[model samples]
Target: MATNRLLRTAGTVLTATALLLSGCSSGDSSPGAAASGQPTNGRTGSADTMPEAATATIKPLPTAVPAALRPYYGQKLTWRECGIVGFECTTMKAPLDYAKPSTATDLKLAVSRKKATGPGSRIGSLMVNPGGPGGSAIDYLQQYAPQPDAVRARYDMVAMDPRGVARSEPVTCLSSAQMDGYTRVDQTPDSDAEVDRLTSALRDFTRGCRARTGARLGHVSTAESARDMDVLRAVLGDDKLTYVGASYGTFLGATYAGLFPSRVGRLVLDGATDPSLPARTMNRDQTAGFNTAFTAFAKDCAKQRDCPLGTGSPEEAGRRLTALFKQLDARPAPTGSDRTLTESLATSGVTAAMYDEGAWPVLREYLAKAQKGDGSGLLALSDSYYERDPDGTYANQMFANPAVNCLDLPGAFSGPDEVRAALPAFRKASPVFGESFAWAALNCAYWPVKPTGEPHRITAEGAAPILVVGTTRDPATPYPWARALASQLSSATLLTYEGDGHTAYGRGSDCIDTTINTYLLEGTPPPPDKHCT
Candidate 1:
C-alpha cells in the first residue's frame, strides 16, 4: 500500500481543513513571512516570530491510579471481525472529562487492528495515525499505511479514531447544500461588504457546529485524545505504546509521550509539528512551506510542454497562478458539473497537489486543461481534496478537522479585524497565499468550544527514543518543524528527507523505508542526525 494521506487548516470544507496542522497548522493559515521551508534556530516560526507555548505546566500524570479512573484503566475490550479479512474492530469508552471522570458523559471510540502475522514473537500493538487532526487513522491503516512485513510480522498494527473524528463520535456542521454554498464563498475578500459576508459565514459555520454537536465539542482537544491513547494502550495489554504518526500525528504522538512518557515504546513521528507555536505563527509558517512547495512545482512544471504556468522562471509561474486565482475570483471557470471552479476550490486543488510530487503530473494535466477554460480536471482535483463524492456527500474529515483544530489552539485571530492586521505578515510570507490563509487562520475565532489546548512544548522527557522525519520542501510540515520538534523532545532522532511532499514515509524512498523499518522492527533509530536524499 502507499504511505497514504493528509491536509492543513482552512483548507478542508470551502477550501480544506488546515488541520492544516502538518501542512494545515503552520501549514494551515497560509504560512506567514518566514523563510519558506528553511530551518531557523530551534524554531519553525514565521520569519522572526516565535509562538508562545502554553504557560500552564501540567503536573506530571500521577503514578497511582484513582478509583473513578480505574474502571477506564481496567476496562475490557470485545473485538470482532470487521470484514476486512485480517483486521478486527471494537469500541472503547473514555470519560468525557478526564478531570471529572465519574460525573461526565462516557465517550465511545472506534478501534481497529490487524494482529501480528508473526514468525517472530509479537512485540505489541503498533498504532498509526495519518495526521489531519481529522485524518481517519483507522481508514489510513486500512487503505494506505505501508505495513512493512518486518514490522507487521512483529506487531499488531492498530488504529483508533480519536474522539470527534470519524468512526468515533464525530462532530458535524453544514449540510451538503449548505457546505456547497460555503465552499463557493469567496475566501479572498476585497471589500468590507465581502469581508462581512465571509465573517458571517464563519460565524454561521461555528454556530452550526455548536448547535449540532453540543457540549461534546469542548472535550475533543488533542490532550484528551492523547489520554485516550493511554487508555487504548492499557486496554491492549501493552505496558508501553508503539506508534507511527505523520504530520499532526506527530503532535498527537508527542502529546501522548508527554502525558505518559513511561508508557512509550517505539514511536515514529513523520512530518512532525512543533506544538510550542501559537496558531498564528503556525498559519504563517505553513503558508511559507506551501510557497516553497509551489516554487518546486512551478520549476518542474516550467519544463513540461503542457505546463500551464509556462516555461519562464518559477517566479513567472507564480505570477501566472496568482493571476489565475484572481481571474477565478472574479469569474469562476466552468466544470462539467453544475459547480463552477471558485477561487477557494481552485486554491484547495493547488494545495492538495503540494502534498505529493507524484500528483504533479496530474496537476499539470489539469492546469493545461484549466487554462483553456475547461475546469473538469481542476474541479476533480478539488473534489478529491475535499473528498466529495459523486452524490455530493462529504466524508466527515473536513467537519471534524476544525472541530479538533479549534479546540487544540486559540484562534489565530479573533475576528476579521485581527486578520486584516495580520495579513501583511502572511502576504509577506507568500504573496500568493498570505491573504486567504490569514483569513483562514480566523477559522477557530468563533468556535463554540473555547480552546482547551494551547501552544506548548512537549519534552516527552524520560521517554524512549522517538524518530521524527521531515521532508525539506514539504508543503505542509516543513523541515524546520522536524528540527524544532526534535529539539523539543528530550530523546528524539531527526531523520531528514531532502525532498518534496507533505510526508516522507512509505512514499517510496528505499532509504526512508529502510531507516524507518529498521527502527520499528529492531528498536533501532537512525543515526541521531540522519539525512536521506
Candidate 2:
C-alpha cells in the first residue's frame, strides 16, 4: 500500500497498525493525523497501459557484510529505559554511505524491544515495520503491535526508526508552520497560476530538506535501510530476521529478502506492494484502490439515515462528494479554528478513512460536518492524517516519507507537462482522486536526491517461505499487489482475506490470526493460496 499517503486505523488494533497512518502523530485526537496517505491514483485504463518500470542493467546489489562494516554488526546495544513502559530502547550506528565504508558520514538508528514474556519456547525477535517507507517502526511496534498471544509470548517484539525517521536523524524539509501551509496547498490547481504556486511550494519543500539534511537525505534509500536492518538484526543477536511488515513495510521486507535471502526468517508482508510495478502503475492502482474503497463506503452509507452524500448509489455518492469538493474549492468551510478546510485537506481526510473501514463512521461524520459549513470534523481528520498536533507540532512521518520514497524510486511524473499527459488515464482510473493525486505524484520530482533504486523483481530464491497477505477490498494495498508479490518471491504463500479496509491480520478474523500465528510460531507456511473470510 502507498502508506506515505498515511494512518492505518486508530483505536482498533487489527487495521490501525497494518495500514497507512499518513503523517505520524504522537497522540490520538490523533484520529488519522497528517493526511496525504499517498499521492497516488490514475485513469481506469487497461493494466497494459501501466508499463513495467525499468530495472537497472546491473545485477541485484549485494548486501554481504564487508570486513570494514563488521564493527557495526558486532556493536552491542546498551539498552536502558526509554519510557515506553516495559520496553527497553537504545541506539545503533551504521555508516551512512554503505557504498563508501570509509566515509565519515554515519547514521544513528533508534531501536526498541519488548522482550517476550513466555511460557512457550522463544522464537527469535519479530522485527516489525508499520510501513510509510517513513512510518516509524518503533512507533508502530509501541502503538500497534497486535500480535497473537502465542506469538507475543515467544518472540521479542522489535522495531527501529529506519534512518531519517522518527527518533533518528530525520530528513527535515519543513517546519510545522511551513508544513501547515504545505498540506493545505491546492493539489488540483485550476489555473496556471495555481499550478505555479503548488510547484513553488513543492520546490521550497525540497529545498528545505536539502538545507536541513542534504548529506543524509540521499542515503535513506530502501536498499540502505535494508542494509541498516541487517545491522539491526546482527546487533539484536538474531541469526535471521523474522519480520511482520505491513503496507510499505512489505517493500522494505522484500528488499531485505532480496539482499539477504538466507537471512529471511518468518516474514509476513501484509498489504503487499509489487516492486516490479513502475511508480506510475503503483500510483494508478492505488488511486483506483481508493476509488474502489470510497464506493464501498458510499454503499454502506446509503443505508444510514443521514447519508451526507445522497442515498441513491455509489456513483451518486461520488458525484455528491465531487460537488462538495468544488464547493470547498470556491469557499473553504470554517473549522472552528483559524484554519479553514480546503480541498486538499478535505481530500486527504477522505483518503485517511480509505485506509481502514474502521474509519468509515468518522468519514461520514466529517462529510456531514463539512456539508454543514463546519469544517472542523474534516479538518480534524486531515490533521490526524498529517499528524498535526493541536499544539502545532508534527511528527517527522511526512518528512521521512518523501525522503525514502524519492530515493527509493524515480519521480512518478517527470514534470507538470508529463502529469498533464497522464491525467486522462489517471482520471479514468479514479475520477474522484485522479486529478489531485496526479499532482501529488509530482512531489518527488522536486526531491533533492536522485533515485538510486529501480523497479526489479525479487526472487529471494533461497529464502524461507514468505507469507504475503492481502485484503479483497483493501484501499491502500490493492489485492493484485499481494498476488504479484507472492508470485515474485521464490517461496511465498499467499493469504487472502475476503474483506474490506487495508489489512486483515487482526481485524477480528480468527482464521487470519490463527493462520499467521501458526506460521510465525511453528515455522510452517500456510498451505499455498489460503483464503480466509
Candidate 3:
C-alpha cells in the first residue's frame, strides 16, 4: 500500500509465482544454458573498448585516508554463524551523517555472507542487493543462499543491509493497525472531498515518519547508502568491489560506481533504473510498464478455458478488468474479515502479479473469485504485495520505501492539484493502472524532509565493464530504464532479456544466466548488443 512507484525487487512476487507455476527457481540459482536460445541484431559500442575506457578514465581517490572516515574504514568486522545453516552475519559501523563524519551518532549496519566453496582459488567477495532501496540485503542473502555454483566456486557471496533497512536500524514509522488503514485508503479519488482525504493521509504518513524516525529521516538518502557501501568494501578487505544489484539496487550500484569508479571490479546491474529521470517521469513510465505487462497477461488469459477476463481480445479483457475495479471503488468486495478489498487494494493485487508471467494463472483465479464476491484471494495477493503478515504486523519495507524515495529525489507532485493535472497522461500510459499510480505518486509530496538528491546521469566513466540487464516486459523497472542506465554508464554493456519479469539474471533465462555467470567468473561482459529469450 506504499507508493506503487518503488522499484521493488521480485522477491515476494517470485515466491507467489513459484507457488502458482512450475519451472521457477528458488531465487538462488538458475537452470543451465538453453542451447536453443539465440541472439538478435543491434550493437552499441564495441565490448573491447570497455577495458581501455575503464583504465584511461579511472580517477581514484588519494592513497591517504580522510582523517574523519578512517575509524569507520579501518574498523574490524566480527562474522558469526547466524540466520541459516551456511550464512555468517556481522555488523559494521557507518557515520550517521557522511557530511558530518565526526558526529557522535553512528549506524550499525548488518551484513551476511556465505564463504566460497572453491575448487578454484577464492576471488574476493561478490556482494548482492535485491533492490527495494529498503530491501534487506542480509535477508536477500539468506533467502537466496548459495548463489550459482560457478560464481560461488570463486567469490565469497556477501550482502549488507543498507544503512536503514532490515537488520540495520530500519526506518520504522507506522504501527500494524495504522498501516492496515493506510493500505485501504482510496488511491483513485473522484470528488474534491476524496482528494482532500488522500492528501491528508499523505500528510499524516509523513507526520508519523517525522515523529518516529526523527533526525535519521533526513540522512537515509541513496547517496549516503552508497557511501556506506564503500566503507563496507574497505572493511571487507576487497581491493575493488564486485557486486550484483537488482532493480533499485542497480541505482545504488551505479551511484557507487559514480562515486568510486576506480574501485569497481565487476558489477552486474540487473533490472536497471535510470538515474537521469525526475521522480514524476519515472512514475509515469512505470505506469506504462505495468500496462505492457498486464496486456501480456490478458493475452495469455484469453487462451484459458475458464479465463475470468473472458475469451475476448486483450483490449476487451482490460475493459472488463477496469469495470471490475470501478465496481470495487463503489462497493468494496468482502474478504470474510473486517477488512474488505477496495478498489485500491484490488488494483494492487492485480498489478502485483504483473511482476512475472508465472502469476498469470493466479491472477485469473483471483479475478474470477473477486467477480463472484469472494475477495479473499485478491486480498491475499494484496497482502503479499505489501508484505503484511496474518498476525497484522508489517515489515519495515513500506516505511523505509517512502523514506528513501522521498529523500532520494523530489516528490512527483507538490500537491493534489499537480496529480490531477497529470492524470490524463498517466491514464494514457496505463488505462487501468495510471490514475491510481498518479495518485500514489503524491505520497512523497508531503515528506517532512526535503530531498537531498536530484535527477542526473551517472556515467561511472572509469569503472570496470558493468553489465546492465533489462527485461523487455519488467513491470517495476521498465525495459527502457535498463537501456537508459546502460547508455549513461561509460563502461556498461547492455544485456537484453526478451522476456517477461522484473529482472533477468536468475529468472530462468539460460542466455542471461550464462552471459552474467561468464562475466562474474572470467571478467568478460556480454557484447553490448546481446539479446536473449
Candidate 4:
C-alpha cells in the first residue's frame, strides 16, 4: 500500500475521534514550536510529560478475586471444531467492569486458533490483530496470517474479536440504507450552509450510534480491550503474551504492555503510534506523513507510462490529482447502480491505495476509470476500505472505530471553525489531501461517549525489551512516532525499515522479517537503531 493513503486515513479517522471525545487529559508535554529545534518528544521527555513516570501508584485492578470468586481461572475450557478444517472456535467471558465483578456483564469473545505443526515445542500463543480499532482479527488470521511452516511450527496462532467488534457483540449503528446515505453525505462542504449541513449529518450519525448501540459503546475503550487481552492470555495458559499488531493494533499491543508489563513476552508492533501525544498532535503528524507518502506516489506516477495524472513532474501530478478531487467534490460520479460515488468515497479510494505498493497499479487503473466518469473501480476500492459487502451490509468497523478511538484520546478540533483554522496548515502539509482530511477530523465532534484516557506513555518499568518497528515512509504510523515511542519506553528497541508502506514485517523485507522473527522465536530483541535497507 502507498504510505500516504495509510497515514491519511489514520489522520482523518483518528482526528475525528479526538474531536468527538474531548476533555480527556493527554499525558504529554506541550509540543515544541518550530523555532525550538527540539523535536516533538514523546518517550524520552521529562517526568511531567510521562504519566507512567509520575503515577507510580497502581489502583488495585478494579476488584480483587478471592479463590472462591474466581470461577473461570482454572476451569478447563471446552473447545470444538469450528468448520474450517483445522480451526477451533471458542468463547471467553470477561467482566464488563473490572472493579465491580458482581455487577459485571458477561462479554463473550470469539476466538480461533490453528495449532502448531512442527518439530519445535509450541512456545505459546501468538496473537494477531489487523488494525481497525474495529478490524476483525479473526478475518485477518483466516486470510492473511502468514502460514509458513517455520511460523506454524513453534506457535499456536490465535485471534479474537474485541468487545463491540465483529462476532463478539458487535456495536450496530446505522442500518444498511442509513449507512449508505451517511457515506454519501458530502464531506467537502463548500459553503457555510453546507458545512452546517455536514455537521448536522455527523451529529445524526453519532445520535444513531447512541440510539442503537448505547449499552456497549461506552465500554469499548483501548484500556478495556487490553484488559480483555489479559483474560485471553490467562485462558490460553500462556505465561507471557506474544503478539503481532498492525496499525491501530500497535496501540492495542502497547496498551497491553502498559497494563500488564510483566506478562509481555514477544511483541511485534508494526506501524507504531506514539501513545504519548494527544489526538491533535497525532492527527497533525499523520497529515504530514500522508503528504510525504503522496509526494512519493506522485514521483512514481509521473514516471509511469499509464500515469493518468500526466508526466510533467511530481508537483504537476499532485496538482492534477488535487484538481480531480476538487472536481469530484463539486460533482460526484455515478456507479451505474443506485449508489453514487461521492468525493468522500473517492478520497477513501485514494487512501486505500496507500496501504501497499502492490495496490498502486490497481489505483492507477481505478483513477483512469474514475476520470472518465465510471466509478465502479473506485467504489470497489472504497468498499474494501469500509469493508462493505456486496449485500449492502457494512462491517462493524464504522461502529467499533469510533467506539475505540473516542475512548482512547481527546478530540483534535472542537468544531468546523477549529478545523478551518487548521486547514491552511493541513493544506500546506498536503495540498492534494488537506480539505477532505480536515473534514474527516469532524466525525468525533459528534461521538456519544466522552474520551476516558489521554495520550500517555507505556513504560512497564520492569518489562522486557519491546521491539518497535517503523517504515521510514510509513503513512499511517509515521517513523518519528516509532522513534518517539522507542525513546519513551525504558526497554524499547527501535527497528527501522528504510522503505515505504505501513507495517514492515511479512511485506518482503528479509532484514525486517528475519530480525523480528528472531526476536519472537529467541526472545532476543534487535539492537537499538537497527536499520534495514
Candidate 4 residue lDDT tens string, 288-404: 777778778877887899988887876787788877777787878889898777787887778777666667777888899889998888888787666678899887777777666
The prediction achieving the highest TM-score against the true structure is 2
| Consecutive 10-residue window with the lowest summed lDDT within model 4 | 14-23
TM-score of 2: 0.92
- Predict model 4's lDDT versus the native: 0.69
Count of clashes, each model: 34, 32, 0, 13
Q: Give the top-scoring candidate (lDDT).
A: 2
Task: Please give, for residues 115-181, the per-residue lDDT of candidate 2 as tens digits.
Answer: 9999888888999888876778887787767786788889999989888988988878888888888
Residue-level lDDT tens digits of model 3 in 1-533:
25432222232335111100000000000011011011111111221111111111112334456798899999999989998898898889998876567546988889988898888999999999887767777777777532588888898899998866778888988889998988888988889998888888778888999998898887776767877888988999999999998878888888788768889999988888877665677777788888899889888898899799888887899899999999999999999998999998898788777887777788888899999998988888888777787898987877777788777665667677777778888888889888888888777778888665555567776789999988898878889988988887899999999989778877788888999999988999976669999
Q: Model 1: residues >4 Å from true position, as ranges?
A: 1-18, 21-59
Clashing pairs in 3: none
Model 4 TM-score (2 dp)? 0.88
- Return the TM-score for candidate 1, rounded to 2 decimals: 0.91
Q: Write the per-residue lDDT of candidate 1 for residues 183-240, one digit (tens) a residue.
A: 7778789999998888788888889888888878777777778888889998999999
TM-scores of the candidates in the order shown:
0.91, 0.92, 0.90, 0.88
Query: Which candidate model has the greater lDDT, 3 or 4?
Result: 3
Q: How many backbone clashes does candidate 2 have?
A: 32
